[model samples]
Target: MTHKIAVTSAFGVESVTKKELKNLGVRDPKAIDGSFVFDGTMRDVSRLNVFLRTGDRVHLVLKEFPARSFDELFDGVKSVPFSDYLPTDARIIVNGKSVKSTLYSLSDCQKIIKKAILSRLSEDKRTTYFPESGPTYEVLFSIRNDLVTLSLNTSGKGLHKRGYRDLVGDAPIKETLAAALVALSPIDAERPFVDPFCGSGTLLIEAATAAMHIAPGISRDFDFLHWNFFDKKLYEETIEEAKSGEKKQKLPFAGYDVDPSAIKLALRHAERAGIREYVHLQARDVKDLSHAKSHGCIVTNPPYGERLLTEREALELYKTFGDVCKRLDQWSINVITSAKGFERAFGKKADRNRKLFNANKECRFYQYDRL
Candidate 1:
């Protein structure tokens, strides 16, 4: 059955909408605030679990309604044909969000719905166990102005957990965001891509993976694996297809850092992910990244003075960063930073700027296109 599935994306970031869905073979995708809505089957869910790289989570929104009180919430949940989805002993968890609604406490709202579901199941099906011992349904409640929107989390764990990076350095960029940045940036595998301050090799790995058409979830497992409706034959078919689809492509991407320990971790992670052959690792300073190429792209998340160094050292780093970009005049540059006066220190105006949150810190994506 074709169903309306809502994919949870990074809040306030629109770059991962249609492109991400397309990468996962999801057709006719619609972009929504902090989410993407699409139509697919249980088999497609298996593909998403293995291939999607930019979304935080993927949810299947069951229903939305106006509920002013606890009774209304109960009625709304019981309205759905839960007998078809939830087994007699299935566990249930409620994760919710509220904005300007009569439902003040999330716990209270969850308890009421649970009671209603238990009552309906026990009375109609004569099932005593409220939560059976199989899969789980994480229902989300979004209450706004006395209205409730309930949805089931298909992807139990966040998509960012690609299950490859066993080692991460200080101030590591999320794999999802790194992949999104690579997709939105001007970097192409035809030339070379460099991340001078690439901690944990996220940007480089994402670039190499994109170039080779390797499935992001190749070594990862997801929550949908434990769902009652999950089909093993269909899931295995998807995995085999993904494996067959991978092709050898040129990925001249490299990562460099001053910390040898960080470089060691990145190398180990790439080895574990089975993509070390496609990436080159080095321990070097940002100042050494001068004039690598004129037509490629230079992207990095440099030291932001958080746990690395002082404000003065960060400023000097930015100054040197400006020099590197200026020297490599033919390369388009895209940087993600939270440093104050970044553009000013770089001595160049960005062609485009996008505001996004990195680890809850407001940051910007500064882009410079060499025209």
Candidate 2:
């Protein structure tokens, strides 16, 4: 049976997530706020979880209906055939959010939804209480202006936890956002890629995986793997297909950080990501960045000065970055920073700028292409 799936992403990367869905052969992916919806089979669920790079989580959309009152909300949730996807032994966890909706009590909404699901399942299993000692099925709900959308969480942990980066440095960029930064740049397998301010080396690692066409979720397991209805063999086949599609390409990628400890952590992360062989990492300041390759791409997340470094220090770093850019004018530069006067400090305006969010802080990705 075909199912409606919602793939979640960061606010600014809806388009990137949609493109990834399309690349996975999802038909007519619909872009929405913070997510993209598509229709596919259960097999597509496996494919999406295994291959999506920029997506935060994959959810199996269950139902959407208006719920202005508590009774309406309970009835709306109870109408879904949870038995089809969940077994009697399945542990159900209900999470909810309300935005500009009449049923604004989140705890009450969660309680009502949980009770409704239990009532629906009780009829099938003839049990008053579920033992709840089984695989988990996380149900999520969003109520917007009295319309409720419910879905099952197919991805357990967020996709950004790609099983690598067991340790993170200060102000580390998320793996999903790092992948988006690489996808937005003009870097490929053949082109050289560099991240001078490589805190935790997320961008370089993501770039290496992209260059090799490695599925980000290859090393991880999804919540659907524990579902009763999903075929384990199909998931295994999907993973094998992803493995087969990986190409052994020579990726000219380098990452540098001023802190030796950060470089050490980055190298360990690279090793964990299975791209240490393709990536070159060194402990060096951004001001000393130099490369023999011309027209390469430098995609980096610099220090935002929010917690680390003063505003003056961050500005000085940008000035040094400007000097580095002038020395390597042939290379394209893509920088994500929350600094207010970034362009003024960088000594030139970006050819293009995109609004992005680094975690909760609003930031801009300044792109300067080599002319």
lDDT (10s digit) by residue, model 2, range 72-119? 999999999888887777888999789999999999999999999999
TM-score of each: 0.93, 0.97
Which ranges of candidate 2 are over 4 A from the true structure? Answer: none
lDDT of 1 at 165: 87
lDDT of 2 at 357: 88
Q: Looking at candidate 2, what is the lDDT of residue 143?
A: 94
Query: Model 1 over residues 177-288: C-alpha lDDT tens digits?
Result: 8888888787666888888998888888888887788888877766667766667887789889988989866577889998999899889878877789877899998888
**CA shift at 221, candidate 1, in angstroms?**
1.8
Stretches off by above 4 angstroms in model 1 are: 22-28, 130-132
Best by TM-score: 2
Candidate 1 lDDT at 300 equals 84
